[model samples]
Target: MKTYTVNELLKGEQLLQQVKVNGWIRTFRSNRFIALNDGSTLNNIQCVVDFEDTPEDTLKKLNTGAAVCIEGTLVESQGKGQKYEVQVERIEVLGTSDPETYPIQPKKHSLEFLREKAHLRVRTNTFSAVMRVRSALSFAIHQYFRDNGFYYVHTPVITGSDAEGAGEMFRVSTLDAKNPPLTEDGKVDFKEDFFGKETNLTVSGQLEAEAYAMALGKVYTFGPTFRAENSNTSRHLAEFWMIEPEVAFLDLMGNMDLAEDFIKSVIRYVLDHCREDLEFLEQRLLQEEKGKPQNERSEMSLIEKLHFVLDNNFKRVSYTEAIEILKRSKPNKKKKFQYIIEEWGADLQSEHERYLVEKHFNAPVILFDYPAKIKAFYMRMNEDGNTVRAMDILFPGIGEIVGGSQREERLDVLKERVAALGIPEEELWWYLDLRKFGTAVHSGFGLGFERLVLFVTGMTNIRDVIPFPRTPQNAEF
Candidate 1:
């Protein structure tokens, strides 16, 4: 007898063959039927028990969440909703879960409640589907990059330089907190720290990837990045994964093309490979939105929204043009926007980005040439001297799905921007060296991997999509 997964046995490939299966019991009904799942698929395989021949002790241990191994002959199910089941001839309990203590139950539980039990949330249908789609999307990301002549690069997780230059970084010093080494001026001395200097978790891999792109021509990094921002919003996460791709000679326009093509390619792969999980999530979203008002609901279903992105070409609009449109739109005129688009330099919020995508363009929109002051120091300065060659790809629900810029390859111009921002040149000397040696017109974008997962899975909260969400003041498990 060969051991088979619930997913394999459910396929009816070896009907009449004796099979051994191991899974956690989902439900044991009437002491004769066991619904078993082994995390192989969302669907469970029915294991019909022989109550007459099975020992009473063995049957008693076959409760929900109990791990069990069943030796049975596969047969076509006479039951409804499923095609095949197992006729159990022998059974052994691997681990017994106490029903009274198990946190997960068969009934519908609140997402909030599930978050508390994040350790075991994957056992639920919604989360199982979500994680499966997440896995597929991960594979799709690497596959797309590999097939497109890009090399995968692993950037350091801890570094001395701040990539975002926002200064909201989690310190990685292995020094005493209360009684640390003091400098001559009485400030905590970082010279005695583990790395002999200050370091923190990386905020983004773009800077490092740029270095690699200079050598490798095309390279990408898929890894975890940290932020110390104290935000409790549904969209904010203290820790998240980012997919950043850097190309040696790609401009802003070419960067936009790559972002669009890359997103569509991975999404199409998920649509092709993870249909069952995606369909399950689609229905889950439909049910979740049923209680909301008609105006608040999505016009297209989850699957429809994904196809809409793939089928349509993203509209390209300049920052100045978008400001003009927003200033003249009904939302701005009627004071419907929470943050009014009063001027060109005002950073666009989620509401403004949503209007451009959902109303103004009625399609995905890529806004470019953001004001230099609002963008980071690395973006290429435009000829006008007011804006940088930066672009943000906005989606229907998520405001900005991708952000990128043509990095400033001109050594003098980049130094000016860095000095203007008061960033010390020494902190980024290695980065400046790339421009000194062999810099070309290069561009890349950072896609928040969780946001993409959120969009694909129709998961509203950023926390629900990640395995262990690190948020403000909450680091449990």
Candidate 2:
């Protein structure tokens, strides 16, 4: 007999057909009703077991987390929670779980408790729903880019380049670490290494994508990015995924429009296609915030927040204007901000970004033209000689979700900026060569894939969105 999934069966289709199904038993209530789920959907199929007909030994194996395959006839259910169920004829246990030692139970498990069992957490309702949404969001990203005439670029994961210039790199070396080859100048020799030069995992793919964008007109890269920052906060991860898109002949304003439209499109896609999973996550977030104080709870539900972003226009303000506003605002004036905003050159912190989005503008806001001293050297210098053409998109709950700028296309100006910033020019000779050979005005932005999922799924920590989080001092699988 052909096999069927729980999702296909629950669609109220072709009733009374013989079927074979495989799933794990979620609950064995009264030794007759087996709640089985195959991870195809959030809901499970209730399998009615006949105690008098089935052997006692086979019935004893029906427990929580036990994998089983069942052959039965579809029938209408009288249960309170579900609509249709399967009337079981023959059953076989694919795998058995000891109820006495199984970590996951039928009751709700705390997110903290679930992280420890990362391998098995997907068996639960919460993680399963989250992963499904995550999978859908990835698809939406590719679809949005593909439909818009953007070519996908597969950038290298390991490189001899430090694109960010922040120097937070995980060195990719194949030489002896304790003691090995040394140079005559009394320094470790990277010349004899595996690649014949020093290399590390890429922190961002923007530079490589820019090279492709100039050739392909429009290109994007969605891949893994690595960093070695020793941050144990709920926000930082050693490994994460980044979505970067570069376009030729696009300026800062056009970049802003593309960013906003792209974000809303993918979010709307998830809202439309993953309705059942999103509904489950929405209810989950609602229940989690019940015990918190009214002031501490989320102002809007998950779906409400998603809809607000889709329907609203992101407020745009120059960095200078934002500074003046912050200087006169209640947070700065009343001495409430942790990093008090005082002058124009002050880099905006999470606290400041949150205030602008949640309280000041009361909507999603984009701050642009940041100080040249704070932003990267690749950003095009403004006419004022003090600010760069950089923009950061800030959301209400999460502070900054997107960061990008118009890149410097002038060869002389870029070389001067590179030298002034004390960044090595020879290592980035190819990067500078792009400007030397027919460089046109181009722009791109980088978005953290996990952060977008966090905003959509109502997940708090960054680690929860990833499958196996690699953090400081925690690499346990």
Summed backbone clashes in each candidate are 0, 0
Off by over 4 Å in 2: none
Per-residue accuracy of model 2 over 1-477 as CA lDDT, tens digit each? 979999999986847999999999999989899999999999999999998998998888888999999999998888688889999998999999999989888998999999999999999988899999999999999999999999999999999988888899999998888886999998889999999999999999999999999999999999999999999988889999999999999999999999999999999999999999889999999998998899788888999889878988999999999999899998799999999987779989998998898888988998999999999989999999999899999997889999999999999999999899788899899999999898999999999999999999998898999999999898999
Model 1 C-alpha lDDT per residue in residues 1-477, reported as the tens digit of each score? 789999899888999999999999989999899999998899999999989999998888888889998998999999897899999998999999998999887889999999999999999989988898899999999999999999999999999999888999999988989899999999989999999999999999999999999999999999999999999999999999999999998999999999999999999999999898889899989998999999899988999999989999999999999999999999899999899888879999999999999887988999999999999999999999999999999999888999999999999999999999899999899999999998799999999999999999999999999988999998999
Instruction: Please report the TM-score between candidate 1 and the true structure.
Output: 0.99
Best by TM-score: 1
Ten consecutive residues with minimal summed lDDT in candidate 2? 11-20
Q: What is the number of residue pairs that collide in model 2?
A: 0
Error of 2 at 300 (Å): 1.2
